[model samples]
Target: MIKVLIVDDDFPVRMFLNKIIDWNKHGYELVGEAIDGREALEKIEKFKPHIVITDISMPSMNGIELIKNIREKKYGCKTIVLSCYDDFAYVKEALKHGANEYCLKNQLNDKILLKTLKETKNLIEKERVENGQYESMKDLANKCLKTLRQQFFREIINGSWKEKKDIREKIKELKLGDDLKNKIIMILEIDGFHKLKFGPHMRNRQILYNSIMNISKEILNDFNDGYVYRVTDKQFLILYSVHGEKSQLNMYKGMKEFAVRVQKNIQIYLNINMSIGISEPIYSLDRIDEYFNQCKMSLKSKFYMGDHKIILYKDIVKEISTDPIKISNREEKELIFYLRNCQYEKINYYIDLYVTGFKERNVKIEYVHNFFRRIILIINKVADEYDINPKDIYGEDTNPFRVIENMETIFDLIIWIKRNIEIVTGKLRPNDQNKFEHEVICEVIRYINCNYMKDITLVKVAEHVHMNMSYLSHLFKQQTKNNFVDYLKDVRIEKAKELMETHNKKISEIAELVGIRDRRYFSKLFKEKVGKSPAQYKKTIG
Candidate 1:
């Protein structure tokens, strides 16, 4: 219900106005009445009415003065001015002071007053909707501006923003001036960003972006003037003005330490590898763009130097004189040859050589992934030519071609690739010598199903098959198209799911029956495979 207040110096007028209108029927309630505008203000504060119907000629404060005060106080109430005369001047003044309705005292009636009140309420609601829309638009504009700033920073640091006039215009737009003389740029990239799966349900992009922005904000809070922007989807640009005491290098080092601390403290935290680019101190605003490019070059150095803690513009320039050699096709083939042989030590040696070579030549991480992808394609082609199943070679849980951790040695990668290839291709040929391999696989599967409640391992399965553990794993995948561990887990999960659906078994009992002693691990595995917990699955069946 809408609350209303009536203010008129004449007691008879207030009483008549109150009685003439059926306020309750019209979805309104008369909360209070005051003889003067000053008294009306007091009642307004107490009642917090939605509508105020007041006389224009009141002592202490009139309708126009009261409306002015309400507007100043930002009260979202509708005001209707009551006047003895239909004077154009009084109506205009009341309207200008945020009054929503104007009524002449002589012409006052229930119909006129009701119609005026209804119209005022409609107008009030409309304004509220429009105000909400304005706020939404304002928020969107701020987000767009932030994105634009990040883009500008990226372009400037990369030396793409070369035009003086363009730089000036951007500076004017961002309102950054000579005051930001001690500006420092920090380029932060999420480690294993490409490995992260982004799908309809997985909002990885937004999560990473928000995390980086939040961290940047925390780091720059102590600095008086600083701004953080998403330079790219993967990288963030933090622009901060260091106080006179701290050098650019010192500030960059501090930010690196802060980033490390944050990563350690936050669970599921991004292993953020940052490349800080420190520009020379600029006294003039015109050189801001130039320094930005310098910082970008510094960041680019990370591609060659690997995950760098800090890179300065001066260091990039110093190393610019010599160009490093690119990895040759012959070298790549040689590395693959070593990998195919399972020469783990040799593979490490070559990988180290390749990484060192790339560092000397300044190859970026993006290029490295591309190069590795090409190598994986080649390995796949080789496997196909040899009639080898690629999945059998790589196993189920691990990617043979993936570069794990900071293994910069090409030799180590080569050995990993070879071992995976051998695993897949070793079983491509028929078991001419071992005629009992298929029977062994069948018996193993039967044993796992029957004794799933007991602790089982590859060794037990191998012993039951009267073969070595490694050979049994190879034969299992070759025959069943899955790894031993994965197949075992799947069998256990399926049995648990069946019990949950057909039998009235508790979750703990089901987990124990599946050889899963840890209830939490059982639940996690159940949810991952079945898309719900054991209890949830039972509820659905019921």
Candidate 2:
């Protein structure tokens, strides 16, 4: 219920007004009352009422003075003035002081008072509804802009915006002007986006999206009449009108400086590399799709030119070379040889060369996936020849298989494979004939180490290892002579003990670095595993 504060110099006037009006029926309640304007001010502070009904003539302060003070303080309260005289001067003073209505003492009755109260409530409710609608519209606009940005980014990354009608509709919805006179499309792509991997539960995707959106908003705030939208997961489209027929080179210089500011302010590890596609301002939105394609092609130029830079499509026209980098029979043999011999570094080196070559030659990453699948088939045949378990060699549990699904870059896949291969081979003692079992243990250990921040269960470990959940549970116990969950806790405790030896870092930082995201969970695990909380352990060490 809306709260009302009744104030008047006369006690009888206050009591009679209170009894005459049905405050509840009028959607209000007399939460407090005062004899004079000064007492009313005190009660206003105490009750924080939404409406104030007061007499204009009072001691120490008048109704007009009280309303003036409230307005000066920016208090959101409605006021109605009461006076014995129906004088125009009193009404004028009250209105000037932000009183919503004026009333004469002799004219006051339940009918007039209730009508005024209901009217005030309706006005307040109307303003609230209008504000809420504005908020909803703003939210919807933001969401639509985000979706368009994602679609645009995907097209740029995928090398073409095939959906022309959809692009045109988005541009129209954003109210982006068709007087593309001096308009340019710049694609700001974050370098090494594929290298930054977050586990599924980390919600890293949303974090990255929010970061890009916030950074884009900050950068675009300088443009008086331009829209900046995320064109993709890692790219943003900046649509701005170039002021006063600036030279293309001058515009490029300005864009580069803006990108540098974004990098400095955002603090993301990757530098912003932009590919600018300048369109001869066309009068039609249909032409935007063509320019969008050109902007996308500019991003592909980064594959030919190395990192930490910008590429302009106009500048690279003559040098735009496209030569297909076919996976020759000999190259395939060499790649397999590196994988089989466990030369992981060489594997990654070749993968980078392969991906770069493909980008330069206009070969899509999906096509490269097909090539890799074919190579994997050949590798399986070789595994069969050597009588090695194909499942263990190219196992679904292995990082190579998982990386193929998650990682966009060949380098990422090679790195995962290399690390797993090292764990399989380097950590095994001589005469350990059960190499596959040893590899599974190493994978489990790696999972435990990587996920110490989460509640690591045996089922989760087994799922990662791609074994029957229960069968792996029994196998893990037999192999380690301890339950899988216990082993994981022991591993976390051991890491925590090492962290306690360091005097500088906080216990929380150590907990996070060791894979425990929650400080409380880390402390609990520390207590469970080491018979003491993390703080206690630190104190004991100190």
Worst lDDT run of 10 residues, candidate 1, spans 424-433
Model 1 Cα lDDT, one tens digit per residue, 377-471: 75676668667566545545756445533333333343344444434333332342254447777667656754566799999878877998988
- Model 1, 297: alpha-carbon shift in Å? 3.9
Q: Per-residue CA lDDT of candidate 2, range 146-251, in tens?
A: 6766575466446565676876776666555443445666666666676567777748677776776677677767643455666566676666566564576776
Q: What would the TM-scores of all predictions be?
A: 0.56, 0.48
At residue 488, give the lDDT of candidate 1.
83
The alpha-carbon lDDT assigned to residue 387 of candidate 1 equals 75
Query: Number of the top candidate by TM-score?
Result: 1
Number of backbone collisions per candidate: 15, 5
Off by over 4 Å in 2: 1-170, 178-183, 190-195, 222-225, 231-234, 264-284, 306-309, 317-384, 388-542
RMSD of 1: 12.5
State residue 300's C-alpha deviation in candidate 2, in Å.
Answer: 2.6
